[model samples]
Target: MARLVRAALRSNEYGFALETPRAIVVDEGYERYGVTAEIASVIADGAFYYLDAPVKRMGAMNVPVPFSPPLEDMTVPTATSVVEVAKALCGRL
Candidate 1:
């Protein structure tokens, strides 16, 4: 539907529609490999009409996880980052 605001898929998809003009799919996988990437790719490849804007994918930074506590925190996606991305996708950022 046109009014579909947002959707997030983690493990499995059960009759979910990827035809929202402004939907944001957040990938919460912290590791290098996650199933969400596959789901996002599948949705993005076939549902172009529903994707008015490019889907935003957020995950761990493209670097090795740091050992220091503070650095580790910076390497992974934080609550603020999620909120910011969500707001951006919703055109509120």
Candidate 2:
């Protein structure tokens, strides 16, 4: 993911996409387990200047998975959600 960040920064892209099974919220006082937060920190520490826009993250909702298949499906991010996030990141929505 760092490599991808570097590449996107080197290029003229607006931003990059990050997909994870777990949600990563910033400044929620739970840094120990936030992969997105850790990655954001790395970018801020090492490649802040290269960012043309904020990093975009797409992952599961911040809730335990439901036992029911339908509810479980709703808790996780889908490809459509990711695309929507990417669109928003690019100012397309």
Candidate 3:
């Protein structure tokens, strides 16, 4: 997802991937996934915002993060989901 977002930013020359004002708003996913401090800092300074309609990212269903590959496949989002989130953020959805 980061790759795709970066690609879009590169292609459009948008300020979506730079770290300036430091206002990163991830999809509320980091906490659940145990994202690192470095990653959080980068996202905060670089990305600054998310692209999901949920505003707060997806909610925790109280279910564990899947370990099985197939379960993970069902639980985690796909590239298409990321794209849709981006589109929604861009107001193109």
- Give me the candidate number with maximum lDDT: 1
Looking at model 2, the pairs that clash are none
Q: Which residue pairs in model 3 clash with each other? A: 19-45, 24-48, 25-48
Q: What are the per-model C-alpha RMSD values against the true structure?
A: 7.3, 8.1, 8.3
Tens digit per residue, CA lDDT, model 2, 1-93: 567655654473324322221222233223344656656665554445655565555455677667999887776666777777766666699
* lDDT of each candidate versus the true structure: 0.58, 0.53, 0.46
**lDDT winner, 1 or 3:** 1
What shift in Å separates residue 51 of candidate 3 from its native position after superposition? Answer: 12
Off by over 4 Å in 2: 1-32
**TM-score result, candidate 2:** 0.57
Please give, for residues 1-93, the per-residue lDDT of candidate 3 as tens digits. 556545544564436444232222334244344433334444443444542222223322336777797775656556666667656665687
Model 3 alpha-carbon miss at residue 43, Å? 3.7
